[model samples]
Target: MTVSIWQSNLPPLREVDFLIVGAGLVGCTAAYFAAQAGRQVVITDALDVALGASSRNAGFMISSVDVYYHHAIAKYGHDVTREIWHLAKRSQALWYEFINRAGGTVKFQRTGSLLLAESEAEAEDLAQAADAMLADDLNIIHHKTDPLKRGYFAAIEQPDDGAVQPFELVHAIRQQSGVSVIPNNELYHITQHDDKFVTAYTRMFIFKARQVLLCTNAYSPRLHPYFINKVVPTRAQCLVTEPLVAPVLNTCGYSDYGYMYYRMTFDNRLLIGGGRKQNIALENDTTEDRVTDPVQQVLDNYLKRHFPDVTVPVSRRWAGIMGFTPDSLPLVGVLPDMPDVGFAVGFTGHGLSLGAGTAERAVNMMLHGTHPGALDAKRLEPAV
Candidate 1:
């Protein structure tokens, strides 16, 4: 007999027009907007909600790009990159809008972010990128400032950018409009039919719906083979320091070409993360939720490099896996053969910044069969 993914855990799924897999920020946001539009939605996750990349981040809600403006302009051209940057800004705005509407205990800090440039040449590039953003009438402050103890060449001060408790936002979105969030109910597999999809869940529960959106992000490759070539799982290490006696990091900070980032939590704790580029081979791992000593050492010693005065015991350290794409953009449309199934993945570590807007775009595509150029089917077709 073939063993079932779940033993004696028979749960019933009901009246679900939209079955969304993965209860991270992407999946939860999908459920949020889908139900907000008066659609019956059921969302499932392998683990508890927000336990993935949704919560395991530095929690900067800045509209900054993973592929920064300079690099993006070079790779995808100026026009396409500008459109992508606007979409990223819109994604951050989605968080703020939901936080206001939720009217609950959501932790959102409007702490502006500083993108640092270490070298004079790099600073010039940053200045140009800032000019591009300013030309579009977006909020931007470009100047040479020694904000950090480690003297930087220049910085792009994004005033509208801020930080948010990503887990709270994910939870709040689900809580809105009675979306069914089946946590601890892992989706082991998905069977795509000609007209619909049948999902296999842990605890012997299954659901069929006209539309199924795979918002699983990193683990999306397991359910669909196409993602095996498109999306690659990458590990990100993060840590939180013991409460500081005085405020150390005032606003969200990024440096070294967006490869590293740090921020201050509400309780005067410093949360720092992002060092995958430091050790590409080791950080590319996604097998476990544990942090490697090499990356942890980088976080452990980063304080001395920037703020020598602030010293605190390490409170906690952990790691989470996120999906990456070859092009550093997300795949947010249906597969070529699977008409009834649509999906989104490969955020390239900018999931929080892009999840909500991309999820909303997925909903629009599913509903009206079209969407804005920023997140339409043609831009992110998995095959391409």
Candidate 2:
């Protein structure tokens, strides 16, 4: 006796000034701002709240860019890298402001995080990166000491890093958006109609909007060819251990330039996720959510190597899909030729902290006709 979403209670011909896809942090935040700016808005999701990337993440408001400072500098050059990092910190600030407006009860805390270098060469690179960040007036410390080094050569602490309950963050943002949320209603296909986008998701969705924002992240390419093969849908697996008395990790962090990362929950449980590179072939796909044994084995070994004394049982194991760009930036712009539609996808796993501010900028780009500054519009354009 289950009713299809098409048969669910919905208007046959609903209209909105703005229709946003995806209900994750980015989408929700975008909807919040768009509605605040007086746009009749509605948000749709493929699944229930907190079931997608927004829920299945390490729950961190990590301060730095997904591509570390040194790695990003190597690719995008020093000045551009510095700009990206500064924008990343700005994104974190917007997120904090949003959370505070909602009474700051999202388990949000400014717990500084560390990036551990595995070798002396890597340690040197970390120190140089730290120096560059300091020159940019960003707070960071490079420690050569092994006190908090869990089998690493050295670590750099980013004092502005923080953690939050991903579910709570989205939930809090939804409260303010006032946008109609329609979950379990996936946007299968969308078409341009009379200068408005007509979306089909369970019987035409009865939705028409002057503009549509594709915040679908890993699922972006599936809806529009503009992002095909550019915004790569990557898989990341994670596991949470049973609550322990006291965990060594009190903050959110990553290692080896974000190939692996771990963070502690407020209840003193360690949640470690990553290692997609271990099975590069298997992890590079568009839509696969099943947890593989090989990746799980790698995570188990990571825990044993780092937290030897913690014999706590694993509470659960799961996987989430994230997007990565050919270059380490998200697609944040209106369609090159089609100006009526816009998007802000491909966060590369840093969207947890960067999504809110990124969405705000994207909203401005759409409504106010201003170009996005935090992200590069030229580099993120559809692959020609």
Scored by lDDT, the top model is 2
lDDT of 1 by residue, 17-79 (tens): 888888888888888878888788888787877888888887887785665576777888878
> Which residue segments of model 1 deviate by more than 4 Å?
1-15, 196-202, 372-384
lDDT of 2 by residue, 1-384 (tens): 233666554647667778898888899999999999998888888885557899888877777766557666777887777767766777788778778988856778788888887678878888887777777777888888544657878888888888888889888888878776788888766666455454444444656677888889998888778787678898899998999988777767877667778888888888888777788898886578879998898889889988787799999999989998877577788765566778999888878756877898899999998878747556755387
Instruction: Give all TM-scores, in the order shown.
Output: 0.91, 0.92
Error of 1 at 99 (Å): 1.0
Query: Would you list the clashing residue pairs of candidate 2?
Result: none
Error of 2 at 133 (Å): 1.4
* Shift of residue 101 alpha carbon in model 2, Å: 2.3
Worst ten-residue run, lDDT, model 2? 195-204
Alpha carbon lDDT at 338, candidate 1: 70
